[model samples]
Target: MKNLVELDKNHFIHPTSSIQQQQEYGPKIIVEKGDGIFLTDKEGNVFIDAMSSLWNVNVGHGRKELAEVAKQQMEKLAFSSAFSTFSHEPAILLAEKIASIAPEGLNAIFFTSGGSESNDTAIKIARHYWRIQGDTQKKKIVALKRGYHGVAAASTSATGIPEFWSMAGRLMEHVVHAETHYMKGTQIAIQSLREIIEQEGPENIAAFIVEPVQGAGGVIVPSEDYLIEARKVCNEYDILMIVDEVITGFGRTGKMFGIEHFNLQPDMITFAKGITSGYIQLGGVIISDHIHEVLKEKSKGTLFHGYTYSGHPVATAVGLKNLEIIEREGLVENARVMGNRLLKGFQKLQEEIDIVGDVRGLGLLGAIEFVQDRSNHQRFAPELQVAVKVIEALHQRGIICRPVTYEGVDIICFAPPLIINQYQVDTILERLQDAILDVRKQLG
Candidate 1:
């Protein structure tokens, strides 16, 4: 253990982590193995993976089928670039399968390595599509404040989280942010977007990107008509709508995609995370037939964008098998059932706990916002790091969750795997209750 800690401290670089803490303590837990919704660390202590390990891992872990498919694909033809007509069966079949399950009219798929790449690609393609249509000036992007896209350059620029932008440094200048759904309500959010569009002049805007449910920004589920109204506003301005479903795709939302819950058609959708259920890296952008047809007709030559691992054979194979497992096991329906149980549990906690201010969830994604005074919805002092403290308490009790601070409020999020069972749900609630109790005592 000491050797491994030394190795990690000396050589490894973690993402979105505290470097000072890592240098002082190495890792919080060195995960050795995972099965279903539980993870075992190197020290043999088991934990409930309540956050689904970054809100991916929809199928849980230790799935032999995904491993077998990956092995077979690797043995058959590990990798061959899909650049310029070169292709593989896994890539082609996976694309077809994704199209069949994706929202209607989003028939075209462009493979990417992961969510960040998918987001970056979506930004580029949106501008490229407008360029092809002879609107070269329509290159700006509009995103929602408190929405998280990815950590890549363009995507990071689109992120409404101020801290991410500060750390990323020198973000793209074309991106602008609008009010989030939590600003007032969906109606106010829609109006704010329209105001931003008017201020920026729609002629300069290429696309408006949003997460159907903002994941990292506190699992914020907006009003049902939020996206619908926003889509109408975009349509009114000729701005393409892009949905980032990296965390809400697959079965996390209990509907394969979060957008399906809204029943709105987006011009482009960026997906990852659950496509292969973390078995392998795979993500892509599904464009509507309109964008595809425009590109097909007007592109001069050479798209001038792609990744070495794009259309990777093993990754696509794993994705195909992962989708198969999700369907055959009825995991999506399970997510809906289990998610309701979790949401109800949070609501119950809110009723009992003084600090639990807001409990919001949909499908398997949920969050419990903590506050100083529930009556006035006063946030705890930031210096106290209340959410982080609660998360530490939860972690000590053999549960893993994430702390989300957005809009100057702290929240603890839950996004268990879609395969979670009733028993596990109950266990999660029991443990979480105890953890909150511990924090409350400390606070008092």
Candidate 2:
């Protein structure tokens, strides 16, 4: 274990991690195995995977069924490119299954390797769709503030978080962000979208991309009518709507897809993560029938955009088995039921703990924000590192979660595996309460 830690520190440059921290502390935890909702480290310490390991793993972990399917598919036909009319059965069947379950009129699928590539593909498709129709002016993409797409070049530019921009100097051009999270009582956010459209000259805008419920941006669930109004605005200006479901798709939010919560029919839906329960790498963009028709009718010789692993056979096979497990076990419904318990637990914590401020959740995705004064909702000083400290305490208490301190908000986020049971939910809440209390006492 020591040698493994030393090797990791010397050779591994982890994604989305601080290099300095890794050098100083090695790895946070050397996870050795996962089963159901629990992960065991090399040191034999057990932990509840509360964040689903980056908001994926909807079907939990250690599923031999997915492994068997991947093995069988690889042995038979490891890989075959989907480009140039060369196709395979796994890709075809997976695409068909996804289309059948997807919202109405979204029947076309374009496979990619993962979330970032999927989102980048969707953005390119939106631009290509407009270009094919001689709307060459429609090149700009508008995303919502606090919305997370991916880390690819185009996806990063479309992402609304500022910290992501600093990773690589000068993100892609022609992407802008508008206000978001305005509830039913306020139309400021929607109005902001309209204003951007008007200022940018709707003709210059290709698509308006957003997440149904912001995940990394603190699980911010917008008002019920927020997306409905945004959809109307997009329709009014002829701007295509793209929903980034990378984190919210495949039962993460209780529903099959997060857009289902708002009854939205977007022009494009980018998805990944839970499709295969993180058992294998797979993702794709689902396009509405209208957009498919446009592409079919207008696209000339080679589409000229695709990834080497666009339609991996083994990955798609694993995805099919993963989806089968989700349906057979009814994990979506389980997520809904457990989500209610989790939210209630959050409410209980908020009521009992003075530092616990706002609690918000949608399906299994939830967050608890910390405040210095509950009466005025004043935040603790940044130096206090309240969210980080609480998360560390939870880790010590055998729970895994995430901390969101972006834009002056101190929030602890949770998205446990959809297969989690009532007892597990209660356990998470109990430990979380203890962790928060521990942090409070330390602060005092």
Candidate 3:
């Protein structure tokens, strides 16, 4: 294992990581096992997975049913192409089950490997639909300024994080980014849609994509009427509204899908992360029948877009079992109850901690922004790395949380597994409180 670590240090390259840190330190924490909401590291340390292992793992870890289903499906049909007319039972049934649970109008499903692929697939579908209707000029994808899609070409272009662009070199063309919801109040945020559409000319815009609750953008929850109003604007301008539910889907927001919270059905919904509880790589874009029918009538040939594992039988089968486990265990209701508990705890922390500012959340998705002066809502110097220090402290105390540094603000976010109990929530809150106190003392 020591030799293996040295080998990994010499050869392995990680995504979204500091390569220098990895090469020098040789992997900070080597995770060995996960059971429920706890992860066991190589040194026998157990840590609460507060971020649900990257905002997935809704059914928690060590789900034997998922493994059993994957085994059975692999024995039956290990690999198959979803290209052309080829199909499988797991793929077909999972799509039907997803349609039943998805928002009212979204009934069609196109599977992918994960969130980035799902988002990029949605972008392609939007452009193709417009082209099929003889509007080849309508190809622009407008996303909110701070919204995060994924790291793929089209997804990264649609992402509003500037740091991603700094490293990703040139992005795809005709992708327009609009003002974020945080730039102004709800009314102005909604109006920014119209402003962007007008400025860019609606005829050139094919779709407007956004996260129902901006997760990577510091869990920015929009106003109650934001999505409803945005839907109206899209309808007014003949633009398709694409909702990225990658983090907010599958009971992350106390509902099956985040769009349900707003009472709006989107033209296309890109989802991942929680679908298979991180047991397998699975994601998809659910399109509305209206859009599907339009393509049926207007399109001439094959859609000309698919993945090697678009609808892998094993992944879909594991997804079926994962969804079943979620339903049987009532994890969604647990997320609602436990999320309320977490939010109330953070609110109390805001009262006790001077740096804690603006605790916000829905269901298991929550975050606490750190500020230099809470009263003034002033951010700490980026060099201070306040959020990073707090999260590292939490890690030492056997808790895991994500540090979000975007747009000059620092935040520590939480998205614990839906199966987390009240006692576990208390443990996480207490550890977090201690970590914050420690950070404050060090700062002073």
Candidate 4:
């Protein structure tokens, strides 16, 4: 274990992690195995995977069915590129399955390796769709503030988070952000989108992208009508609406896809993470029938954009088996039931804990914002690091979660595996309450 930690520190540059913290603490926990909703470390310490390991793993961990499917696929046909009309059964079947489950009119699938690539592909396709229509002026992409797409070049540019841009110094051009669900109201948020389109000249805007429920941005669930209005606005301007379902897709939000919760149909839906329950890397963009028709009718020789692992047989096979498990076990319904319990737990925490404020969630995705004074909803000082401390406390108590500290927000996020039971939900809440109390006492 020590050697592994040393090697990780020396050779591994972890993604979206603090290098200084890694150097100071080596590694926080060397996770050895995962089963259901629990992860076991090399030191034999067990933890509740409350964040579902980056909001994926909808079907839970240690899925032997997924493993067997992967093994069988690799033995039979390890990989066959989908490039140049060369396709495999796994990709074809997986795409068909996804289209059947996806929202209406979204029938075409463009495979990518993961979330970032999925978003990039969606963005490019949106532009290509407009270009093929001879609307070359439609090039700009508008995303919502606090919306997290992914980290690829175009995806990074489209991401509304500032830190992601600051880290890489801006990767792509022609990307802008509009107001998200602000405290004022969803109307104002909708107005912000309209205003951006008007100002940018709707002709210059190719796509308007957003997440149904903001995940990394603190699980901010917009008002019911927010997405409906946004879709209407996109239709008004003839702009492609792209829904980034990388985190919210595949039962993470109780529904099959997060957009289903709002009854909103998008031009394109970029998805990853839960499709395979994190058993293997796989993601794709599902295009609406309208967009598909446009691409099919106008696309000339060679689409000119694709990944080497676009239709990897092993990943797609694992995804098919994973989806089968989700359907057979009814994990989507389980997510809805467990999500209610989780929200109720958060409400309980809000009533009991003075610092707990603005608890929100959809399906299994949830968050609890911290405030110094509940009466006025005054946030704790940034130096206090209240969210971080509370999460650290939870970590000590065998509960794993995530902390979102972007844009002056002190929020602790949770998205446990869909396979999590009532007992596990209560356990997470109980430990979270204890952790918050412990941190409160420390602060006092």
Q: lDDT by residue for model 1 over 312-415, one digit each (tens)?
A: 99999999999999999998998899999999999999999999998999899999999999988899988888899889988998999999875568899999
Which pairs of residues have clashing backbones in candidate 3?
Answer: none
**lDDT at 386, model 3:** 92
Residues 128-232, model 2: lDDT tens digits: 999999999899999987888989999899888898889685368899889877232338888899999999999999999999888998999988888999999
Number of residue pairs clashing in candidate 4, backbone atoms closer than 3 angstroms, sequence gap of 3 or more or interchain: 0
| Alpha-carbon deviation at 20 in model 3, angstroms | 1.0
* CA displacement after TM-score superposition, residue 318 of candidate 1 (Å): 0.4
Model 3: which ten-residue window has the lowest total lDDT? Answer: 176-185
**Candidate 1 or 3, higher lDDT?**
1
Task: Note each model's CA RMSD in angstroms.
Answer: 0.9, 1.1, 1.0, 0.9
- TM-score of candidate 3 to 2 decimals: 0.98
- Give per-model TM-scores: 0.99, 0.98, 0.98, 0.99
Candidate 3 C-alpha lDDT tens digits along 225-278: 888989999999999999999999999989998888899889999998999999
Clashing pairs in 2: none
